[model samples]
Target: MYYINKITFSMFITITLLWSITLTRIYAESRECDHTKCVKTLADTTIDMLIATRSVVAKNQDLINVDPVSGNYYFKGFVPAMVGSEVANDFSLMTGHKLKQTSLKLRNPNNAPDEWEEKVLRSFEASGYPKGAGFGEALVTGDNKIYRYMKPIYVEKACLECHSTKKNLRPEIRKFLEERYPYDHAFGYKEGDVRGGISITLPFGN
Candidate 1:
């Protein structure tokens, strides 16, 4: 009877442990799904805002320059920064760090501009995603409280007028870009080619 009771107690403990593990896994999965959904929603809203603003900016020539009061341009050549600011202001309510955009063109074989561009490309390949077109979110370290969301922006036919390697860009547009970004590496793009990415940062702790 004593041996039987001991066996029964051990079985009960084992069952309890199994139940705890199962519950933990369920909770973890629930949390992950919630996080994913939140991030996706934010991305969708951000994309909508960016596309709308881009359309307006593309149409109107006057609102292109930096705002004298805010010191922010409506459509900065840096796509990532524009997207980041929009997301931070509209969706994230200026919470945490703002998003950032960066562009990468086919290296000139003469001078590559920034290191981040190469790093983004390598990361895209290593992640097993498509080389030129992909998007995702990642956690940024430093107390593990920040998240950086990234999405690739491919060049389209309309983009070529200003982005191509050929110097047929409108004189006014070329002059504006030259003055703003003297070392601009945001050109030399063809339609359907990977130009760069928009990165959005949010505080994980929030």
Candidate 2:
């Protein structure tokens, strides 16, 4: 199996978000199509962002400094999940939509799934669900309608650093996680397991 170790986590997402930034404006024209076509383009754009991000980050790791300071065992401030959250926030601001990363087992309690997200996460976990396929719906809330889009994120061999079984985690990484996220259940994942997903909400009339 291919793995790039732990430090590449932030690099992976940073690159992905950058890809989203550049392409969202380019693909914004596609949203003027019919309702079904609009939502489909949005989801497709995000997935394409992933494809391009992985390819770009693979070629560009020289900028990522994984070297550790004396006492600290692993990198901080830019962990995979944290970077993902930040990336979502920035992307949301740029596009005037709500972008979020959420998981059934959360590292950041702030990312706890709402009712809709919870139901979707359960569906993702259910056996026989298609791997890597995204789910989307137009939700009616109060007097407004909105489109919610989610695409699942799968665990890779590279993800084992912070999300593998407890026994498999390096002591310092475990300790760092314990102190940072005491209620963490975002671990014990195998390579192909569903890690979580990218959730986006577009205003109804947008």
Give Cα-based local distance difference scores for all models. 0.49, 0.68
Q: TM-scores, in order shown?
A: 0.53, 0.77
Best by lDDT: 2
Q: Which stretches of candidate 2 lie over 4 Å from their true place?
A: 1-17, 20-27, 30-33, 47-65, 68-74
Q: Model 1 lDDT vs. the true structure? A: 0.49
Runs in model 1 with CA error above 4 Å?
1-34, 59-93, 105-118, 123-134, 137-140
lDDT of 1 by residue, 117-177 (tens): 4576556635556744435454556566444456666566666656786387766567766
Candidate 2 versus truth, CA RMSD in Å, comes to 5.7
Best by TM-score: 2
Q: Can you write out model 2's per-residue Cα lDDT over 96-158, one digit (the tens) per residue?
A: 667677889888899988888888988999999998778888878888677787878888766
| RMSD vs true structure, all candidates | 21.2, 5.7
